[model samples]
Target: MEGTKPKAGCPRAAGRVGESGMEGALVWLIYQRAPGVGRRRMAQLMRTYPDPEVAWRLGKAELAAVRGFRPDIVEALLAVRKSAEARRDAERELERARRAGLRVLCYGTRGYPERLAEIPVPPPVLYQYGPWEPDGRPVVAIVGTRRPTAYGLAVAEQLGRELAQLGAVVVSGMARGIDTEAHRGALEAGGTSVAVLGGGADVCYPQESAALYRQMRETGAILSEQPPGTAPRPENFPERNRIITGLSHGVILVEAGERSGTLITAAHAIEQDRDLFVVPGPVTSPLSRGLYKYVRDGAGLAVSAAQVLEDLGFLPSAEGPLHFTPRGLTELEQRVLGWMGSAPWWPGDLAESSGLPLPEVQACLTMLEIRSAVRRLPDGQYIRIG
Candidate 1:
């Protein structure tokens, strides 16, 4: 984040894009709802029509002439614009959002999150419900599987707590498992946590999280690109993940299965060039498999919050070195544990590396897994958890 200055016109150069400018932005929010329409097509529209307001007035035949415009989607767009209903609907929703204490961050205007502007399809208008700071404080995303093991949950909460206490804003999807725990931890530390929703910023999908939602609304911030009344659809999550990555200084994967939805966020982090860290967990647990793979593939291995803080140039100072206890570990298990680094390793490779028989190496790994000292990966790799 060093030397990363906020862009011009992002509240530093001017004021928020007024209601009139919002109309220009509203074209995107409404058009994207049409099937197969997205940021790319919207970009095309802006180029083809030059003025968003003029594009909004285009008839079906005019729209069809644009390159890459689909026949089916053109009709959908025409339907929404039929009698100017879509424009009115967007206007009314924008008014409702303002009445509900939400702020609209119009694209190409003042007050949008600066980091998001660097992404490919930054939301045209973000429905936000709290304060925004573009003063260069690091924003770290803590995400994991929705159904995590006890260890994964614990690590996520701890990471969130420590990061917030050390002066970083925690960014997350506000999903059921790890995201919820991370947000709670940030709140526990009296620090801000930004919740990016897959649905409307006004809608809290898991009704059980209502209390937490209230806390965030009062203290942190809740944002969404979806329209005011949109429901939580399955397809909404991947795009939501992109926003999470788009808004962070880095990302932490506490745990993930091979097929967990959290992988979507991880992929976005890579594509966005956000630094990634993975917390190792028990190999026998499916929740930890993807994390081990990430570490093996060159993601940073996170053993403590200080490691991340130091990498971010937060000047973290550790009090003491981490110590290991082998009181209950068999001699072979202890030796195998010693051989394993923070990086993940396979038993076959470990056997060769440690000069032990393959069967003996496998046995030691199972012992370590049972003791919660090593985690098993989906592809039979292992990593030290402590």
Candidate 2:
């Protein structure tokens, strides 16, 4: 069994594999389609058995011995396993997924996301479609109202663009307003982004985001816990929210009114111990109600993109390169940098040559110095060091 490769259509095991090794993925597939079985229930079973294959081997009487599995859940589990129809359906679904070229990852698959596994009751099976790989870049989730005001849209797009430009992965639900603009910003910046869907991985829910969905699948990923062909039901959004936050180190709330679904994501972030930051918007706007309240209750305020990075411990409070991106430099800083060469140029000369004010030039020089792109000479001259 040492070099045994999982043959095509052979369901790879998550934890300990039984004789077949296909039990884990197949059982998970069955449960995904089975009624009365869900994430929490699956989690409970995993707690006791450690592997779906092990759980699958348990008879009805033995399964009843597992604590915390309610009678109904136990009954459903037994029923699903015994029903031949259920197994055929799960196999058919998995086969469809395979034919579609989608990646159906069990929890312990080689390519499964680590951050997602850290959450409480993480999805047993994650359906992914796109090029997704682990990278050193940090990930941040941005959530907001579906019906965002002009201001909210601007802020969401700005956050997405800035975060992506800094080489951070932007995560968001592919909903309307804020989510749409956020993903668009990431794409515009040529950055990686992940969209967690409330519906099936292949179904573009809003119908309008179809093009964006395809674009994401091309460059990034569009994934969901829901099985393929599953409709976007009202109850599925909250379930989708947990995954959005779980995959990121931090969550940015751009705009959310009271009772907004965005709040559900925020709650998940808190439960997962992910950093929470809220963008402060105009108090007059109803969209800001939930976000402003979070700030009031002690969430980090997103005054700028730098603040979020700094809070994540990616930035130096005093001075340093701070993972500076060329695109992130201020306009004046870019202008000042353009004027520099191997030779040192004092701020006075730079301002005069670039047609910028001396004070602005000096400010840019200081910023550049802090960024470690320039070194300050004894005579107050600046030279590009990096």
Candidate 3:
């Protein structure tokens, strides 16, 4: 949450323009629709004319005089300003968003994401659906391949669940494979999860993710820089990666191949100076090559969600309620722990109940004891502990 404050002089820093909340948002939408006005150009225009309304009223001569405004760019702005159709489009877009119950945030306005505003070329207009708000809690992003190995899937889901349980907001692109699992885990834990889409906030790219798309809109949020009704084009994803990392305090790469698009997210994280963590997959896996390269290049090695929370300074105090979930436990250990309760039970009884060999049960109990998750009593019984 550090460094998330909105920069001074951002457009509409005094909040919404006039009495209508959508008035400032409409100006941004109009500017965004202007041809040749990309992220950088839009940023420059906003810097020169903090009030977008002022920019809208500028004549060709005045607009052309602004820094970085070429003849063509100025002409596009002027044309868009003069076209009645352009204004109608912006108005219809806002009306549609309102009917859909979506919130439109113009850059530097109240309710806009402060972290996103800190990016070099933050989107001039953002469309969001949901009620979740950034409350200074840690925001961690989990990203990886669309086609992941079983190991990768499990790791991504477990990490998501643990991070959510620890009170950190989870973020991903809501894509297939790892991203889907990550969101699922967070929702399963009754925690917030945000999806940054490459298309319009209302569109779900992969038809298979329709369920997830709805769930996120209900429990978390769906965000996009693209306007309503915009399709998710191939090129939009790379640009969308920036918003994903820009909103996070840190990013965790679960599993990515050498040429995985997930690496794009990692690059954005590095450029944004956000903490980068990589969950090491098997070196033999083709999916893991990209992750190891980042690890070698100084990214933090993330073996567990707990380690990530600790590295990002999100670990709760010892005096707080002990809800920390242990990570890195073996499958057998997890099974044994699931069967444990506050009531004391002999190791033999646990083995019979869990249908595991007594020796293996005893070994798991010893490991659990060493981890301070269980305490052994003088009566030859064990009780679960924090």
Candidate 4:
């Protein structure tokens, strides 16, 4: 009894601590629902008022003067604060997250991802499960199509393994296909990987990936901008992709069709000015075409793990000589080679016509042309040689 201090009752001590954290949390809630107050606009308001809690209480006239400010945003901000039902719902969500051993970090908190703060459209709040270590090595985002071929899986696995070996942490959307392969490959290689979710961090989409989601939470983290219990909506994905790229040092596209969402992530990477890498596939293969366009447009070509490392400036130079190797080729390469006609073929035309990985098809054609198995005309057309 002499060494022990008397226990304080719940109401006074707990209330003071809660009150200190509550204002910031409330401001974050207001920011999340503020319709037109995006990252830049919110920064503007925060700058003008110097306090988000005070800014949230600003009258319509005060908010209207801010750049890109809108009437609806002010209305939404005020309405959420005034609505008892909305407040109740938010409280329920918070309680549910607490029950699940999760934690929420608003944009202005010490726990918020620092890298995300640099983005133009940073999420005002981030909901996370498990530990988040931004300083933990380099985080590389690996993304691709929802329906990946076995070849894409192979490439993703190889790259992930190499990335892990290099002490890089992999990040992805936790989607099906190539995204799944990337995370799985990283974990299989005994590396860490983060999954940025389109829904609440607690809710796993493609519900079949629940096990993977659990694995990611234990070994890495599951992150989201939405509060817990938020359903998966179409709009959440595009918004979520930014965080995936924002949290990484670079992004690697494994395989993506012309209109793949992975391309959205690549666009975000470019906008964020993070390094971008693409694996080129056959023109005929829907998955590789989108990636080829990125590669041809001066994006780093993911020929091998060392190229990725070199392009990222992690390695001083590429490991070996600049030469082609046949061991990298798959069965699709042999088939595509044997079937080409004597007529000339465009890289796009040939790949689309041959049904191979665009990069693989392109690599083979380049090799064949060099070996006289084919010839490249002055017009950029390819022709079989005698």
Whole-model lDDT, candidate 1? Answer: 0.75
Query: Each candidate's lDDT (Cα)?
Result: 0.75, 0.76, 0.79, 0.70
- Residue-by-residue lDDT tens digits, candidate 2, 92-142: 666656656667766644556777877887887777888966543568888
| Each prediction's TM-score versus the true structure | 0.68, 0.74, 0.74, 0.70
Q: Point to the candidate with the largest lDDT.
A: 3
Badly placed stretches (over 4 Å) of model 4 are 1-23, 34-51, 57-62, 71-83, 315-386
Better of 3 and 4 by TM-score: 3
Runs in model 2 lying further than 4 Å from the true structure: 1-23, 32-36, 59-65, 315-386
Instruction: Give candidate 3 misplaced runs (Cα > 4 Å).
Output: 1-21, 47-51, 57-66, 315-386
Give all candidate RMSDs, comma-separated. 15.8, 12.5, 14.8, 17.9
Better of 3 and 4 by lDDT: 3
Per residue, candidate 4 scores C-alpha lDDT tens digits across 261-312 of 8889999998998889988777798787778877777888787766776566
Error of 4 at 306 (Å): 3.7
